[model samples]
Target: MMTALLLHGYASGIYSSRRIARAAVERADFMMIVAGDAPDFRTISEFRRRHLKALADLFVQVLKLAEKAGLVKLGHVALDGTKIKANASKHKAMSYD
Candidate 1:
């Protein structure tokens, strides 16, 4: 389960997922799995293409662990997204605040 969280949470490309994974890893109660070193951006991109579903499954496993630990309840859910223009976009070339 810890292994799953490491691979899915921190290693996943999604920013929020990585944050969740990092939080899980920091918890002393959870089992730990040491991945030697951080992969470079290119390697991460390759991993996403090659192992996306597997990583997603790991995320799910982490969620189950949280449920088992009584950290999160099984219930309703909501989702939302906010889009900001990329730095490369000339129309939105503003300094990050």
Candidate 2:
């Protein structure tokens, strides 16, 4: 589940939770889950919402370890962007502020 979410967010070029779920189901190597069953959008959203902080922290730790191993330069950051396909209509999405 974690792998699926990360791949979807980082590599799958998908932002919609539904699409992420679909990608995981259709592309096993792209977002392979160890459990063999792909999760739905709601489950993926809940997992991300619940573990956002942990994920951030884990990413930081990976960067630090990479720096220590000379795999990445210290004080340097890389930014990656992917085109996201929006599935929601104006009627389905709203802003709080």
Candidate 3:
């Protein structure tokens, strides 16, 4: 769903996220999700509010790791598209901001 919104330019909304999540579930096995079904709008909304900063920090850490691994070079473009999923449930998260 993040990929759908960020990369594929899908509009951000419950239905858009749900649609992407449901499709990924049908093609399962590689998808990492709790409940293995489309999440409710509240869940998705809360996740973004709670986890966006942490995820951004993680992304920076990944880039530093790549540089240390010699995978990053000046004047060259590279993007590692893999994402780690956090099992955020509505009951387990709080709004830290």
Residues 4-73 of candidate 3 have per-residue lDDT tens digits of 3322213223344456555445545314433355555456556656877875676567667878899875
- Clash tally, candidates in order: 0, 0, 0
Better of 1 and 3 by TM-score: 1
- Give RMSD to native, each candidate: 10.8, 13.6, 19.6
For candidate 3, give the lDDT.
0.53
| Candidate 2 C-alpha lDDT tens digits along 11-93 | 44677777777777777664455355777789878877898888778767777888899987877577889889997987679
State every prediction's TM-score relative to the real structure.
Answer: 0.43, 0.54, 0.39
Candidate achieving the largest lDDT: 2
How high is the CA lDDT of each candidate model?
A: 0.55, 0.71, 0.53
lDDT of 1 by residue, 54-91 (tens): 87786788779989999878888887788876667665
Ranking by TM-score: 2, 1, 3
Worst 10 residues of 1 by lDDT: 29-38
* TM-score, structure 3 vs. true: 0.39
Error of 3 at 49 (Å): 1.6
Clashing residue pairs in candidate 3 are none
